[model samples]
Target: MTDNALAYRRSHAFRTAVTDIGGHQRFTRAYRPQTNGKAERFNRTLAEEWAYAQPFTNSHERTAALPGFLHNYNHHRAHSALNGQPPITRLNNFAGH
Candidate 1:
């Protein structure tokens, strides 16, 4: 039951059930992170929320924390873009409609 996530990439956002409109990328000078703003933001979020959120003694501990982090990120953390609601809320609303 997958949608635009078909075994292909950038097929067409919204062409099917969904569209993953990722930002474009190009060679940029050093210190110009805005060149890949969307990916950069997600990377920073992952770093700040999961990778560096707490101290882990080993790789296993960090691996154990990933599921919890992903759950919180998808179900609890609010996104300003969604009017301060978690992303799952939008999906649920859309599906209900």
Candidate 2:
């Protein structure tokens, strides 16, 4: 989901791209602050923990590291908001877990 930005809400190209990828854009609710705040926090954490955690020799190296980083982030890293549990712990009856 995106914030209530005019570019995301009004840009024809953006909408077309989302549709082309079999997805659609949804905006955060204006009345619920936490929805947007959570997304912003995740972005900050992703940048801090993965994107800038180390120097890569090249873009390819960084790109190659993303899957591992995401696995660790979602399945291993403890989040304060989740009561010190990893994100995966919050799932209810996950298919294979």
Candidate 3:
């Protein structure tokens, strides 16, 4: 309803999808990537390592491979900030620890 909310609805697929699934919509200010710094960094890493490291033969092949890359990134890769734990592990025990 606000300008920022309308902007989010127009811009981001994940936000739009979540809203469609009965989630409430809110908006963070523009130019405030620090608010979601971890996700922003992960996205940069994904783009650098997986998406644009080399030329994809086609868009379909790139799209098809993204889930596997994401799975490995979340489940296997150690993050220094997490004290060397993978994201999946951290997520599973997030509140407990």
Candidate 4:
């Protein structure tokens, strides 16, 4: 889900990618801050822990680091909302775990 950003609404590539992934695109409603809280929190966390965690020489370098960051976030980092467990801890029958 995203806020009502014009780019998301207008970008064909974005829409196509979402569809290709079998995902549905949703927009947060205006004046409903609670509806966007999780997404906003995730954005903030992503920026703080990955996007700006270190200096990168180029966009490619930053882009290449995303998977590793995501893996660590999902498998290692503790979350208060998860009762201080990593996100993976909540998964039942997670393959190869």
Candidate with best lDDT: 4
TM-score of each: 0.57, 0.69, 0.62, 0.72
Looking at candidate 1, what is the lDDT of residue 80?
A: 93
lDDT of each: 0.64, 0.84, 0.71, 0.88
**lDDT against true structure, model 2:** 0.84
Candidate 3, superposed: residue stretches over 4 Å from native = 1-5, 10-33, 93-97
lDDT for predicted candidate 4 compared with the true structure: 0.88
* Per-residue accuracy of model 4 over 1-97 as CA lDDT, tens digit each: 8888899889999999989967799999888998789779989999998999999999999999988998888898889999988888888876635
Q: For residue 47, what is the lDDT in candidate 4?
A: 97
- Candidate 1, residues 1-97, lDDT tens digits: the string is 1222234244453334333323342333446556456556777888998888899999899889988887788788889988988777877455521
State each candidate's clash count.
2, 0, 0, 0
Per-residue alpha-carbon lDDT of candidate 3 for residues 1-97, written as tens digits (9 for 90 to 100): 2224455667778577767856666554566666456556766898997899778999998888887887777788788988988777756465533
- Alpha-carbon deviation at 42 in model 1, angstroms: 1.1
Residue range 1-97, candidate 2, lDDT tens digits: 7888899999999999979967789889998889999879878877887788899899899888888987888888888888987888878965534
Which prediction has more favorable lDDT, 1 or 2? Answer: 2
Q: Tell me the TM-score of model 1.
A: 0.57
The best-first sequence of candidates by TM-score reads 4, 2, 3, 1
Weakest ten-residue segment in model 2 by summed lDDT: 88-97
